[model samples]
Target: MGAEEVLTVISNVGIWRLLKAVGRSRQRLGLDAQRRRLVRSIVAHEERRRVDSEAHP
Candidate 1:
């Protein structure tokens, strides 16, 4: 998907679903390497926050 579409999906669905969506849309979207890296970064950041919150709570 394009940049805006990717950002929109990330914001609306959160990292996990966005990752899943990316898998589903890989052929259709043809997202470039940079975009994939960006998505991975976001997912990693979100995962860290999840772990931090769970440990704190």
Candidate 2:
């Protein structure tokens, strides 16, 4: 299983050091970039939806 799966299965109960290490490993695995782009796309889509609603209502 991936680090995320293991963390979730274990309820993420642990020291900050372990979480940080998993995060670093995921970053090295290119997880960070995927998340960043997904977040940016979601934000842009939300902004567009808000603008369209305001223009019509």
Candidate 3:
């Protein structure tokens, strides 16, 4: 399977829960900026990939 398919499977397996866990860990470690940046980067990258895939396909 492709990277996109793998990502979809991860999402199906409660990625939000995983994100929340990360957020909690970040809070505990006082890494708010790092966590926010990580989340933003992930979102932007995913959006770009989705748009590119749609445009190409």
Candidate 4:
């Protein structure tokens, strides 16, 4: 999923719950690396955006 959708999902699920799910997923078989990477990248992107906005504002 894209960053916007991923952000939506994170908002809906709650970040703590999503992080828990990711941790649990790693313990299970058939882990989806691509999805995890996407989430990570999106999270990093959001973090950067937030920092940038705050810095400029």
Best by lDDT: 3
TM-score of every model versus the real structure: 0.46, 0.51, 0.48, 0.46
Candidate 3 lDDT, 1-57, residue by residue in tens: 999999898887787777777687776566778788899999999999999999999
Off by over 4 Å in 2: 1-29
Sequence-dependent TM-score of model 4: 0.46
Worst 10 residues of 1 by lDDT: 24-33
Clashes of each: 0, 0, 0, 0
lDDT of 2 by residue, 1-47 (tens): 99999988677555555777778777656877888889999999999
> Better model by lDDT, 3 or 4?
3
Error of 3 at 15 (Å): 32
In the predicted model 4, the residue pairs found to clash are none
- CA error at residue 46 for candidate 2, angstroms: 0.3
Alpha carbon lDDT at 17, candidate 1? 72
Q: For candidate 4, lDDT tens digit of each residue in 1-57?
A: 899999998797897687778787664433577678889999999999999999999
C-alpha RMSD for every candidate: 14.1, 8.2, 13.9, 14.3
For model 4, the superposed segments whose C-alpha errors exceed 4 Å read 1-31
Residue ranges of candidate 1 with Cα displaced over 4 Å: 1-31
**For candidate 3, what is the total of clashing residue pairs?**
0
